[model samples]
Target: MMNEIDLTKVDLEKPFMAGLMDGMPGGFFVYRGDETKKIIYANQKLLDIFDCDTWDEFVELTGGTFIGMVYARDRMIVHDYVRRARESGRTSGVTNYRIHTKKGVFKYVQNYANFVNDYVEGGLVYVFIAAARSTHDRLTGLPSMLNFLD
Candidate 1:
């Protein structure tokens, strides 16, 4: 079936994605509507990244819109990628432009996400670790945990 969003239910209501979002390795955020993707839910880790303790402060970051916090150049790409995945009902992944955290300063991170479903309209998801750990050779950025020399 072609999954579609019912905008009426996807407005500024707090999405139904609180619990699952809390478990992601990095952080998670959920915004509603297009004009101002007003953040309805953001996991604690995300709040910690920005030192934000409340949803109201986070929502204001959008100036009121449903776009992600990724770099400007990446928004359209992310949107297109998400739309395609939603249409096919086949899961997809992306190398998202992630605004990351350093010791205290923020940096951009390349991350991945596997979508779950339309928590409202755009869909809720379990975002993965931004910089995944490698267990492989220093020679290559590959998983080597399964095979290594003693």
Candidate 2:
């Protein structure tokens, strides 16, 4: 069996981890766990997803917060999902939501997030986002039921 790596010993800011995150296929970001959910890091894919050319531009558009990155209409839903998950003692969660890009376009995305309570910054959430294609299911190529729902 392969050796299991200890997550607590891994430092996300380290060059190796940073490089891995940057090379990932989807959008990735890290944010504070507080109410503001202040964004600490965002990979290039995330900048592209938001239609931003630079980190400064992304931060400006999102107000450096996860809540600010979400489309206003969907913020409450996303918040409730995370809140409920955390309340139920979940350290991670996945949810689909909409985000308004800098170009004034709204895109549906699936967010996968893991909460780390022992981080140097108290609590932190690492997230990965991908376009939520309503045309087909992720595992199978069958039609997606989400397309028929609101």
- Number of the top-ranking candidate, with lDDT as the measure: 2
Window of ten residues with lowest summed lDDT in model 1: 98-107
lDDT (tens digit, per residue) of candidate 2 on 52-100? 9999999899899999999898899998999899899999989987788
Task: Give the TM-score of each candidate.
Answer: 0.49, 0.80
Global lDDT of each candidate: 0.54, 0.89
C-alpha lDDT (0 to 100) for residue 108 of candidate 2: 80
| lDDT of each residue in 1-150, candidate 1, tens digit only | 999967566544345445446656776655553345455556777765644566665445534233546546557876787678778885647554434232334344544555555754774554443543333444684446754432
TM-score of 2: 0.80
RMSD of 1: 9.5
**Where does model 2 exceed 4 Å of error?**
1-15, 135-146
